[model samples]
Target: MTGTLVLAGTPIGDPSDAPPRLAAELTAADIVAAEDTRRLRRLTQALGVAPGGRVVSYFEGNEAARTPELAEALAGGARVVLVTDAGMPSVSDPGYRLVAAAVQHGVRVTAVPGPSAVLTALAVSGLPVDRFCFEGFLPRKPGERRGRLREAAEERRTLVYFEAPHRLEATLTAMAEVFGAEREAAVCRELTKTYEQVRRGPLAELAEWAAEGVRGEITVVVRGAEPPAAGEADAAELARRVAEREAAGQARKEAIAEVARGAGVPKREAFDAVVAAKNAGPRG
Candidate 1:
């Protein structure tokens, strides 16, 4: 009998958010794989449950090397419980390789669901939640980050992202520049913690607010663009929007394409308008 590979979710902030099954699994597993051994020790201590098996660190640095060993343990009928410092494993964390290895080895895989920052932030964002996408984190590089925002400029579904506190203001400023200053958004910080705060406003407004400084795990939710209404499209407006995007550091080609799509107009018309505007020279 092949042992099961359990991917358990730890608390994001509050300890009570941990599901009852998590404690049971912690006590019963043959081996516990933790992202942070010290944090895992604290969690176990909080839950008052001691594992009957060995506990080993399985963080990003060692994930690749430790996966095979964990898979072997599962193959040998040792129940392995995998847990990150918070949230589910493999979600911007370590665990994908181990899970994939277990699946490939014919080992059964399962999850013990718990509190999730993504879902929690979305639920409280006050934005359309029916359709959405999770963009875990933006690139650290400014050019790459701006390019990514420009790519999602016309997305109609709500967008979610995790950001470091220090980068929040810059990110929001970039977002305002790309997505429009008036775009609605929310900045959720320290979710479920004592100092939890959700600042909701236009991208420009939030950008200015964040400039003052913020500290915590941050999740940003931005309302998606509303599709252009029938017969309301203006080629000039599309071209101007494209120009704004270009000025904000987005590639000219991408700006044109995104603007055209967003305005529900032909790309050729948008391109022509931009060309005409450029040829007309600077305004007096």
Candidate 2:
């Protein structure tokens, strides 16, 4: 009979936050696959459980290759437990491959609930959370990052992102450029920890603050665009925005692309907004 596969959650910040079930699983599993062996040791120490199972590393670099081995163990009736450095396994972490493989091999899969940064940040962010998208991380390259930000600028639903402290400034700057400097956003730092802080303001303002240097893990939440007036957009207003970005030295094509992406409108619609403005003559 195949044994069960458990995806256990670890504390995102404080160790005391670990759930009871997490402790139970750690002490009972036949094998514990951890994203980082060192961190797993720390967790075990924190929980004071002295992890009963044989601990093994299973991070992003080795997840794919090591999954089959783990799956085979599960099939052999090993109570396999998967844990990441923080939060639950397979969440922007490893374990997905092993879990999928286990399921395919007729092994049972379960979980031990615990803390989560994504939900915590969303709750603290001043932005809307009724509907939101969890975009784990943006591209590192400037152009690609900008393009991605622009694509979500006009998103009606709130947006969340994980960003490295070192790149927070550039990320916020690009967001401001794509989503409008005036767009509302919040930067959540060191969440759930003693120094936890959530700074809320316009994207441009956040960008300025970030340039001063930021540290610790970060979660950025951006407000979606306001509903168009009368539930319909103002064509003239849209036209003005397009022209303004263009006047700021952005190429017509590039400006339109950026505006379109941010506005969540099609490229053709943005192009037409500009065309309508140009055809309307000077607005003395």
Candidate 3:
């Protein structure tokens, strides 16, 4: 029988945040795969646990070359523990390759849950937290990133993102353009660590703050758009929205009401949308 694979989460900042299970796993495992061996040493020292196992580097550069070797160890019934620099493994970090290979080989996989910057930032973001999606990292190239941002402009659930300090300003600027300047957002830096800061404001303001320079890991949370104001939409714009929905297969009346809800306009005024559509015909 193949041995089980354990994916342990490391502390994002405060060493005290390290869970007891992490230390137990480290000492119990037959081998430990870490993103940074030096950091792993520091972590074990912090946890005050004697690692009774072999330590190996399993970062991005060597992930491909090391996957097969690690799988072989597991096949030999060796308990393997995987750790990243911070947070849970495979969450925008190393460990995914091993997990995938383990699954392919029918190896048991488990995790020691620990602190997460994504959850921490979202909790304190003051935005809607009922539903959310994590966008691990955006494209470094401006055009590709902007295109992706545009697609999520109207997403109702709050959005979470990770970005390098160098690109935070540019990414925030693109978010302002796509989601609108007035959209609410929070920039969380060095979460749960010294110099931790959470800047809450409109996306445009956040963009300006990022321009001044930022350091440490960052998690950005942005509120969904409030939708366009239907009272401010005018007749033509209302017709356009209704027509667009109808083009997508909604009945004319239903489409108008839905558009009204989205635009924050009264349903009565939205009724005019159907009439406008008739007058304009199917041209536009």
Put down candidate 3 lDDT per residue, 1-284, tens digits, no spaces.
89989999989999999998999999998999999999999999888897789999999999999999999999889999999999999999988889999999999999999999999999999999998989889999987897677556546778999999999999999888666689899999999998999999999999998888999999999997555654567877778767755553446776666667766679777787668667778675
lDDT of 3: 0.87
The CA lDDT at 48 in model 3 is 87
TM-score of every model? 0.93, 0.88, 0.82
| Candidate-wise lDDT, in order | 0.92, 0.85, 0.87
Shift of residue 96 alpha carbon in model 3, Å: 1.5
Which ranking of candidates, highest lDDT first?
Answer: 1, 3, 2
Q: After superposition, how far is residue 3 of candidate 2 from its true place, in Å?
A: 2.1
Question: Candidate 1: where are CA atoms >4 Å away?
Answer: 263-266, 279-284
What are the per-residue Cα lDDT tens digits for candidate 1 across 95-201?
99998999899999999999999999999999999999999899999889998998898899999999999999999999998899999999999999999999999
Badly placed stretches (over 4 Å) of model 2 are: 238-271, 281-284
Off by over 4 Å in 3: 227-284
Angstrom error of the Cα, residue 94, model 3: value is 1.2
TM-score order, best first, reads 1, 2, 3
Candidate topping TM-score? 1
Error of 3 at 149 (Å): 0.7
Give the C-alpha miss distance for residue 28 in model 1, angstroms.
Answer: 1.0
TM-score, structure 3 vs. true: 0.82
